[model samples]
Target: MTREPRSGCPIASTLDIVGDRWTLVILRDLLNGKSRFSQFLSSPERITTNILTDRLVAMESAGLVTKSPYQARPQRFEYKLTRRGEALLPILQEMCLWANAHIPGTWTPPVSFMARKPE
Candidate 1:
C-alpha cells in the first residue's frame, strides 16, 4: 500500500506513513528497547510473522528504523529507531496519558518512559 499523502498537511503526511495499527505498536516496542525480530514477535498482541515482516519493511522504507545484520549465516537483523522515529516519543507519551485518563483498564506508562526525551 503506497502511503503517498493526499495533501501537504503535516498530520496528513505523518499519517500516510504511520496511520495503521501495527506501525505504532512496532514503534512502541522499539521505544521499549526491543530490537530483534523475535523480541517484537513476543509482544502480548502477538503479531503474526507475515505482518511483522511487512511492517518492518515499511518502517525501513519510511526511515523510522534501520536494520543491521546480527547473524550472517541466516541473515538475521535487529531494528533500531532512527531520530525521526525517536521524535515520536512525546506524541506516544501524550497518547498514553490520554488513554490512561479516558480509557478504562489502561495502565500508566513507566515513569522512565514518561520522563524520557527524544534526545
Candidate 2:
C-alpha cells in the first residue's frame, strides 16, 4: 500500500509518512528497546492506546517496523524496526542533540545513544 506523496519536496515527502505527532516518538521508543504495546503506552509522553494503535499500523505499512505475534492465547504482537526504520537512527540522534543544545530544559541522553548506528 504505497501512499502518494503530498508533494515532490524531499522533506515533505518524508514527513508525509513520519510527520505525525506520535510516529517519531514511537520510533524513539523502538530505538530505545521498547517493543510491546504496553511498553509504548508506558512512555512518559503518555500516548493514548488508540493513537498508538494507529501509529503502529501506519509504521508497519510504511516499512519502518515489523510486527510479529509474541503471544498465542490472545494474539499479542511485538514491533521491531526494519532496516529502513533503523536508517532513521541518525535523524533521531540529531534531534536529541538539537533538543539538548537548543532546548534548555531538555534532558541529554547518554553518549552511547548518540554513538549508535543502524544495524
Candidate 3:
C-alpha cells in the first residue's frame, strides 16, 4: 500500500494519521480499553458501523491498529492498538485535559488514569 505524505510539517505528519474527528475518537475508545468491534460501536459517540469499519481498516493500514480473529466459523475480529498507536496516549491525554479545562461541562477523566504511564 502507498503511504501518505506525513512530513510537510511534524504536526501535519502526526495529524495525517490521527487528525480526523472519528480517528481520535477511535483512539480514545481504544485507550479506554475498548477492544472488540461491538464495544467500539457502543461508544457514547454512537459511530455507525460503516464509518467504524472504514476507520478501523484505515487505522490497520496505517499501522495504528491490528485485527485478529478471536472466533471461528463466521470469524470475529478484535481490534488492538499497536505500540505505534499507543504512542498517541500523550496526545490524547493532552487534548482531553485541554477540553476538560476549557470546554463547558466537559467531564473530567480520572486523574489516576491520566497519570498512569503509557504502556
Candidate 4:
C-alpha cells in the first residue's frame, strides 16, 4: 500500500517513499551491489537487524527490490533491484557528487559509482 504524498510537489512525493534516515543509505548499498542480509549488516552505517528488516520489506513493497530464495535449507534470500529501483541510481550518484563537493572529510565515491548512470 502506498502512503499519501504530503503534497503534489514532485520531490516531496518522491521523498514520501525514500525520505527516512536509513532508506537512502540502504539504497546506496543496493546500488553498490550488496544484496544479502548479512552484507547489509556489514555496511559501515551499522543498521540494526530489525530496522534492516523493516527497510527491506518496505522497499520490496514499494517495488524497489525483489528477493529470491538463495538458500533453501534455512530459506535465506538475496535481493536484486527492480527496474524501478535501478532508476534511482542517478539520484544516488548525484548525491555522492554533491557530498564530495561540499562536505568536508567525506570519502569520495569511487569513479565507478560516480560514472554510473541509471539503468
User: Per-residue lDDT of 19-118 in model 3, one digit per residue for the tens?
Assistant: 7779999988888889988999999999999999989999999999999999998898989989999888898889888998899898888776598567
Q: What is the lDDT of residue 52 in candidate 3?
A: 94
Q: For residues 5-111, could you state the per-residue lDDT of candidate 1 as single tens digits?
A: 88999998988898888999999999999999999999999999999999999999999999999999999999999999999999999999999999999988899
| CA lDDT, candidate 1, residue 114 | 93
Candidate with maximal TM-score: 2
Worst 10 residues of 3 by lDDT: 1-10
User: In model 1, which regions exceed 4 Å deviation?
Assistant: 1-3
CA error at residue 37 for candidate 1, angstroms: 0.4
The residue ranges of model 4 lying beyond 4 angstroms of the native Cα positions read none
**TM-score against native, each model:** 0.95, 0.96, 0.91, 0.94
Candidate 1 lDDT at 94 equals 94
Looking at candidate 4, the ten consecutive residues that score lowest on lDDT are: 110-119
Report the candidate with higher lDDT, 3 versus 4.
Answer: 4
Clash numbers, per candidate: 0, 0, 0, 0
